[model samples]
Target: MTQTLALVGAAGGAGTTRLAVEIGATLTRTGRDVAVVDAAYETQGLADYVDTIEADVTELVTDGAPLDSVVQPAALETPGQLSLCPARAPFERLARAKTAGAAETLEKQIAAIALSHDVVIVDTPPVATNQAVAAVDMADRIVAVTPDSERGADALARLSGRVRDVGESIDAVVANFADGTPQVADADTRVPATETTAPSQCPSCLDDETAFAPAVAAAVEAALDTTVELDFETSGRLDGLLR
Candidate 1:
């Protein structure tokens, strides 16, 4: 069966896009076809991961662009394909894409994408806009992505209410940018604060030695209910020393 999960941001810069991309990479390495669909129109941060974008998710949901055409596959050595359907649009189109009608179309568009892909991971903003609500509504599972801080936790608390308003609940929580085990309430895993690397070399979850690899793996297991091959032995400061 196909699985659809939304990684919703607890705050604006909660690293939701990064987490979604990393999750996609990890799933692809397991030989499962994965599509990281972007529903965060305003930020359009997912576009930063892909090399090029001839068309985007906005065009797909708003202008009726074909799914296969907008999907840009990443250059990964994994057995399964890792593709991104990101949104890169101006203010005008973005406004239209967030409309009630467009939000409904967005749900259908995501369902259509799920037909071909084994796993469809929606990169969503906080459940504020109509489109973001649609993303959550269409999702089979939902995970809140937040940074390892009090503000992130507070934002997460707010986000929980918003998600409940949309008739959904959070399946897991991932605390990003942590040196050790983060204390955020309900944080399933802690991803270290990794420095900026080339976009192509990113989703570093594929590398077992990376500090955040084990955390990413744990998130995958906890959120998606799957087993990860990577070991969670090296965590925190020692991870930096080994690498």
Candidate 2:
């Protein structure tokens, strides 16, 4: 069965999309059919990251566009390749993307995409959005990405509760742009917290050598209690360092 994983940003600039791209890239290197879906209709960063604006998830859900028609391959296709379904419309159209039955519509669409891909990594908007609620609802696994700050911690706490109220739980929480400072919360021991490397200045820059992908893959493996082979250098065109 295809694994549907959603990476949600607990706070703004949490590097959620970047992590999704890296994880998708890593999975592709392991020979898994991976498709990263941008559910964050407002930002639409995944389209630019993959260098393709051909079609987006908006088309899939609103226009009833076929999966193949919406999914476009990443710019660099080597060592296995990652596909992306981005948002075609701008932020204002997000309301239109939210279907009448909201969660149900998005879930069905996401499930259809899952049928064709081995792994579907969803990059969701902030926790407050309806798109995020649907993404979390449809995902087989949920990974929260946040900065190592009080704001991120508080946002995560609320987001976790929101999902739990809907009968779901966060599988793991990744602390992006972490500086090893003591701002993370220990409210729950069951939920695992991990850290990812971030540049001193630009936290959004994508770096293949960073521990981001490995950390996320590790968190997923630990949460799911299964090993997922991830090679780190997939983006650099270098041989993958298996973990």
Candidate 3:
């Protein structure tokens, strides 16, 4: 069975996108065909790490376009063997892509992609938007990305309620931008927290140690008990090291 995983943020700067890339890359390294779908149209930096082709999923929904035509292969600097569907250009394309019959259209496209791959990893936008909500509805497993800060925890609380309302469950909570230690409340019991080094310099601390791909691989192994095989050029390089 193909696994469809959605990585969402408890709030912005949760490192959800980074986690998605790691998971996709690891899966691909293991000789599994993996596709990374970027749903966060606004900021699409995730496409840069891998070979990315522009896919207008919204266009597929609105115009009944072919899903294959809409998907573009991302460009990976190194050969990691992963495919990517970049978020639409101009961002608004996603909102416009949601046609009256968009739900079914999007699902069909995703199903087709799933058939061609062992795993599909979706990097979703922040939880409040309808697009983000739609992605969650389509996911087999949802992973929430949070931080160790108090505000981050609060955001997770609110996001958790939203997930419950949608009748979905979060498979894990990745503590992005973690410092010495992360403090998660007892009430948030859906998933345990995984921590990595915090990103530095970047405004969102997006490039911190938490952004490391291997750390994410470890988290996935812990969460799913799925062994991963990676091609490592070096211990720390995120790009060459594929599972």
Candidate 4:
């Protein structure tokens, strides 16, 4: 069976969506089919990674759209497929998608996509809505992504407590845009800041030169409990780099 992983943010603007796309790209490097599902309805950042989203996660859960039909392939040319189920809808539809009944539909849609993909990765926001709760509760493994700061560490603690309330615990933690986070020094993966790109372009992780790719590969490994053969210092600290 395909294992589901939820990469949830500890706070707002934690770079969760970018990290999710990089993780999916890294997994695809190993010939693994990945489905990048979006539960961050508020941000809809997953929409940036793809060219366009005709049918999306919001429609899947709210209007009962066919899950497979909505899963558009990410604009990547890797050996393995990187499909994205994004949320690019109006506020009214988004509101409806966040309802409890729609959350249940989201949970089922996740399982439905898992059948076709080797790994299902949900890009989740902070657990504030019913949809976020559904994603976290349905995931086989959860990885918390936080900024590398004192505030981020505090938020991570809160996220942990919230997960526990729902009978789940974070399997790992990733500190994005790390710049000497003494507060969260023990984060499972420390991702350095890299150059930003347009949402319509390919992910930077596809490049073999940058440290960003290998670091994200490390995060993917830790989050999914799999090995990624990349040449980067995942065990050391690379501070002062922009994410």
Candidate 5:
């Protein structure tokens, strides 16, 4: 069975894109057929991880093209392994499509992509929007990416409530930019915690080794085993939360 995971944030700038890239890359390295789709119409940063094709889910609703044609392979160091489908256009285009049923059409487009891959990692926009809600509603597992700060935790709490309203649950919470400091302990939430360190001074925000690669691998292993191991150097600090 194909497993689908949506990485969502309480609000923007919560590192959902980074987490999705790292996790997807890791899965690719482990010999899995991984497909990463950027569902967020506002930001397609996840496309930077690989050779990306600009696509709008709404196009599937109107054009009737098969989803496989719309997917673009990521241009990461690991080639021929990871695939990416980027959201280059706006969701407003989909909302405006004069299809018989817009929402159902959009859902079918997403389903087509999910059916083709062994693992589908979606980087969703904030939970406050209708598009994000649609992605989460269709996801089998949702990972809420938040920071280890009071405001970030509060945002997760609010998002958690919203997810519950739709009868969905957050499978985990990833703490981004978690320097190995006391601040890491601030995010006290129930979901399993995956802490990532701040990558060196680079344009893209993530550590080199532990950034996207390790996290993606860990998430994949965890999903298969029904438990994500949080023992890597960057993730080790979060062991307490896992226990």
Candidate 6:
């Protein structure tokens, strides 16, 4: 069965979307079929970072579109492919979809996408939003991303408590753009910051060649309680990165 991993930003600028893309790309390089979903409706940042179809996640909740129709191949050209189910609609429109049975419908669409792929990486918006909460509820494991600052750490604690309150376990916590070491006792595993400069094209998407990618993939693997493999190209590949 496919596993869903939700990469959530505990606060703004935590590099959740970037980490999601990097992890998805790394998993692909390791020969896994991966699908990245943009659940960040307000920013639609994932769509900007990757090649996407005209449709968004909201379309999957409506009557006219099929899940595959909205799914597009990400630009990552690894031996294994990376696909994306992008969200491009305005926030108000997406908010409406969150009501009634539409959210459940959206969850079903996401579940179907998971069934077809080896792993599904959900790039969520900052924690505490309804969209983020819904994604967390659907996820098998949550990888909460935060910055190295005290505010970031505090925000992560709040988000972690909220997730646990709902009976979901946070598999890992990644501190992005860390200038120095950041510690937290709540995380099962903590990934140190690797990238300092931002990418020119997408603020969140990191180049696969960067050391950041491998470090994150290894950390996420460790969070999943699997043997950590530091190699990005060869040995540390998980059958399902989120599993």
Local distance difference test, candidate 2: 0.67
TM-score of each: 0.92, 0.78, 0.73, 0.92, 0.73, 0.81
Candidate 1 ranges with C-alpha deviation above 4 Å: 231-243
Clashing pairs in 4: 193-242, 193-243, 194-242, 194-243
Question: Which structure is stronger by TM-score: 1 or 6?
Answer: 1
Q: Give the TM-score (vs. native) of candidate 6.
A: 0.81
Computed on alpha carbons, the lDDT of every model, listed in order, comes to 0.84, 0.67, 0.61, 0.85, 0.60, 0.68
| TM-score ranking, best first | 1, 4, 6, 2, 3, 5
Per-residue alpha-carbon lDDT of model 1 for 63-121, expressed as tens digits?
A: 88877888898989998999899899999999888999999998998888899899999
Of candidate 1, the 10-residue stretch with the lowest lDDT total is 234-243
Name the runs in model 5 displaced over 4 angstroms. 47-54, 76-80, 90-101, 180-216, 219-243
Please write out the lDDT profile of model 5 over residues 48-94, one tens digit for every residue.
54443545445655566567666776555542256676655456664
Model 3, 73-141: lDDT tens digits are: 543333445666655555465556543356556666777889987788778876666557777888887
Model 5: how far is 72 from its true place, Å? 0.6
Candidate 5 vs. true structure, TM-score: 0.73
lDDT of 6: 0.68
Greater-lDDT candidate between 5 and 6: 6
Would you list the rank order by lDDT, best first? Answer: 4, 1, 6, 2, 3, 5
Candidate 6 scores a C-alpha RMSD against the true structure in Å of 5.0
The regions of model 2 sitting more than 4 angstroms off are 77-79, 186-213, 219-225, 230-243
